[model samples]
Target: MSRYDWNDERHALGVATMDATHREFLELARAIESGPPAEFATRFEGLVEHTRAHFAAEEALMRETACPSLREHEADHARVLGDLGRFLQSVAKGRPAMARAYIASGLSEWFDLHVATMDAQLAAHLNARQHAG
Candidate 1:
């Protein structure tokens, strides 16, 4: 595993797509943490774009599967996306340090909670569907 990459076996969901996306997320996080003035915009924007798409995809899956706790899960997604968006905006406006701090602290916490609860719920929901079918 890379510095920012999570182990696949440890993932909340064993879904291939989600696992791949999560790996990308961690890679981007590591990239941003690496620090380079010229590449900041590219890396940061990539992170933002990937994160939005990932959240939307997950939300759509949850909605389609009729996960019982989807509302709470989506709310958490919204919270994380909102914070990330703000961090991106801050960085775009010339505050990379602040964005770095948010990723290191705020985002790390969010990821832990998201993986432990929402993501795990998603995994269970999908696993049930697979078994039922």
Candidate 2:
């Protein structure tokens, strides 16, 4: 089993796109954490790429919906992306230690909290808007 399997209680948002994207995020994280050292860089890169796209998609939804927490959510995404970029740089330099640590611990914690708060709020907002429309 992978280190970070998607849990319905923790990861599901009830919003299809967001839930799917979050699942992909967890799957990528699991791959990065469990795969061979030789493949860590590649898997990590995929995760980073997936995260960029996922964030962008959610940001677009926030823009379309005029989400109240758009700025805050986007800021969180930016901070995490920047951190991931730095880790990727280190990994590229043949130093995957920091990135590995992040995958094993930091990333999982961040995801749980972020999904519970920011993404959950976003999903609720979107659902309400859709229902109202």
Candidate 3:
């Protein structure tokens, strides 16, 4: 199985929208990892675009809820977005080797850690707010 495959126990945060977005992210990552070489650039671009939307949605939620970790979370999103943009540039230039390596390992590792930490915190905060409301 691809490292990008979603494991609910590991990846699901119990926040409906966030969990769904995360599932989509993993699906896109898995597709890029296993897709044909000719399709790599396009698939990678799709992942980047999806990720931009995903991060924006989460950031908006953070803003709405006044999440204490908003700044740190936003910084993490920015860093990942910057990396994705750089990788997209290389892919566009027909130099996909580095980007492929990143997708295969770096990105997957980051996703696991990010979901467990920052996303989990956000999910907990949201859940608490929901229950207390």
Q: Estimate each model's TM-score.
A: 0.88, 0.97, 0.98
List model 1 lDDT by residue over 58-77, tens digit each.
Answer: 88998899989889988888
Q: Against the hidden true structure, what lDDT does model 3 obtain? A: 0.95
1 or 2: which has the higher lDDT?
A: 2
lDDT of 2 by residue, 1-133 (tens): 5547888888888999889888888888987777899999999999999999999999999999899999999999999999999999999999999999999899999989999999999999999988999
How far in Å is the alpha carbon of 26 misplaced in model 2?
0.6
What is the lDDT for 66 in model 2?
Answer: 94
Residue pairs in collision within model 2: none
The C-alpha lDDT values of all candidates are 0.79, 0.92, 0.95
At residue 53, give the lDDT of candidate 1.
Answer: 94
Q: Once superposed on the true structure, which residue ranges of model 2 sit more than 4 Å away at CA? A: 1-3
**Candidate 3 C-alpha lDDT tens digits along 1-133:** 9998889889999999999999999999999888898999999999999999999999999999999999999999999999999999998988999899999899999999999999999999999999999
Q: Model 3, residue 66: what's the lDDT? A: 98
